[model samples]
Structure formats: C-alpha cells, structure tokens
Target: MVAEHSPLRVGIAGHIHLAPGSERPIADALRVELDRISDRPVHGVTCLAAGTDQIFARVVLATGGTYEVILPALDYRDTIVEPSRADFDELLARATRVIHTGYRHSDTAAYLAANRELLSRADRLVAVWDGIPGCHAASTDRTVDEARQRGIPTTVLWPAEARRADRRP
Candidate 1:
C-alpha cells in the first residue's frame, strides 16, 4: 500500500510507431507490466509525441493515475501533436503538469533533453521497446540503458508476438 505521501513515478520510452493492428495488445502489455511493479498510485511522465507517449498517458488516466507531459519544444501544438490533435488536446488538458522545454521550436536535441528530464524525475522506466537499437537519441534502447545506468528499475513491455512480426520474411 502507498503511504499517501509518495506515489510511484513512471517514465516511458518507446517507438513512435505502433503496428497497424497492435494497439490493444501493446496497451495490455503495458498495463500488465506496470501492475507488476507498483500497486501505489502511478505518476506517469512522458513527452507526448505520437505513439507510445500518448498511450502511456491514456493508460495512466485509465488506471486512475495522473500524468505529466513534458514537451520537447514550444511548437508541439503545430508539429507532432497535429496528427492526433484531439487526443493530444485532451491529454494536455488533463495532465497533472505540462512543461515545455527551452527553445521556441522542437528538434532532436530538444527531444533528447526532454527524455533526460523524464528519466531524471522518474522512479522507474517502462520501455515499450522492440529490442532493436536505432539512430534516434531518445530510442527505447537508449532510454533503457540510461535508466539502468542511473540505477532506476526498468520494465520492458515488448511482447514476443511483436518481435516475431518484425522478423517476418
């Protein structure tokens, strides 16, 4: 049971792409994964970009938890948040806190910095990863590695089926 004072803080790192038909499973996996770690009130933190970040925010709300959105830049309203504008707007409106980092525009550097901020504040890291390392600074792999280096417990939610699909001929 939680102490009424401290809540579990969870940060998320994951791919921006969710396969055409994999939303439900991924969401379930994330829920299960987080459940295994803390039964306390979960305070989720993520940069609300597009895919996993949005899902994380939704899951937090669904679980009766709260969330904080750390925007990489100030132009989020016009840039990345446009495709899922309605959902983004709703999440933003419901966030426990909303923070926009330095600079008047978004960029790779800003995103990496935002990721660092999320990691720095989280008590744990939940990686919705593909187990593949890519070029992105804020890739799930990098975030997982950073969490490990910082001694924060990390939970991975990439189901085996997702990996199998990735290896299809």
Candidate 2:
C-alpha cells in the first residue's frame, strides 16, 4: 500500500568512484530504502557523473521511476570522463529534465554551487560515501554534510568495510 507520501522526489549524490565493482549492492540498498521511506515508488535526480551518480540514476530508472539530471557544467567535456562520455550522452537523452548549472569550467566553486542548486529542489537526499573526515576527504561527504546543515533528511550509504574502501587505491 502506498503511503500518504508515497512516490517521493529523492535527490541523489555520492562519490564519483565508490567500491569499484560493487555498485549493485549500493543501488539495491538505495532502492529498498527509497521504498521504505516513501512507502511507495520513488523518483530521483542525479548529476550523472561516472560512478555513483550514474549508478543511482540507472537504479531509479530501472525501478520504473523518473531520473532527472542536473549537470554540473554546461557540456559533457567538463564533467564526464572519455570512456563514459557516450553513456552519459544516452543517459541525458533519457532524463525527464536536464538542467545546466551554467558553469562552463570545472572549478570547485562551480561544483559546490551546482550541488546546492540540485539540493535546493530535493525533499530528501540519498548519498553513497566512504566515511572519512576533513573537507578534502570526499565530495559526497562534504555535500551530505551541507545537506544536513540545511535540515534536509539525508540517507548516507557507507560501505560496510573495515576501512574506507571507496577511496582510490
């Protein structure tokens, strides 16, 4: 039975690379959590970055929900890696809406501003991050903290490992 707040508009953010080959587990968990929270289906927004963002968007789409994208920059070259460029192109085509953050360069200020823009439109935030400390630790962690400070309900999925395995080796 769908709850009164079923079908939530979730906002997703995470590290670009999280658990190299274990994206499925995190995606599955997100699916379950979203269902639990909304008591129904859930749609989400993603930045469509190579790792976590793309994976989350795919999961949302697979679950018969819409995936909206807020690109960090104006063009693909600024945010997408070479090998993943084609995939991003296709994903963009499938998005319910595509928002350009109006920044052409890949600067930290632009990225954070874009993150804020995306978070502003979301009711809840779903984040997949490696538990780490410090500002330069992870963008996902930083963004999640920002969301929390703004009183947005955030669900953070950290890999259940002995250490922060999400970090690049």
**Per-residue accuracy of model 2 over 129-153 as CA lDDT, tens digit each:** 7665445522877888888999889
lDDT of the structure predicted as candidate 2? 0.74
Query: CA lDDT of each candidate?
Result: 0.80, 0.74
- Identify the candidate with maximal lDDT: 1
State the lDDT of candidate 1 residue by residue for 1-169, as single tens digits.
3356877899998877666566667778878877887775589998876778888888888888899988888886678645678878888999989877785777778878888899888988898887879677767788899899999889878876553235235
CA RMSD per model (angstroms): 3.2, 3.4
TM-scores of the models, in the given order?
Answer: 0.88, 0.84
Candidate 1 ranges with C-alpha deviation above 4 Å:
1-4, 163-169
Clashes of each: 0, 0
Q: Which sections of candidate 2 miss by over 4 Å?
A: 1-6, 76-78, 134-138, 161-169
**Root-mean-square deviation of candidate 2:** 3.4
Using TM-score, give the best candidate's number.
1
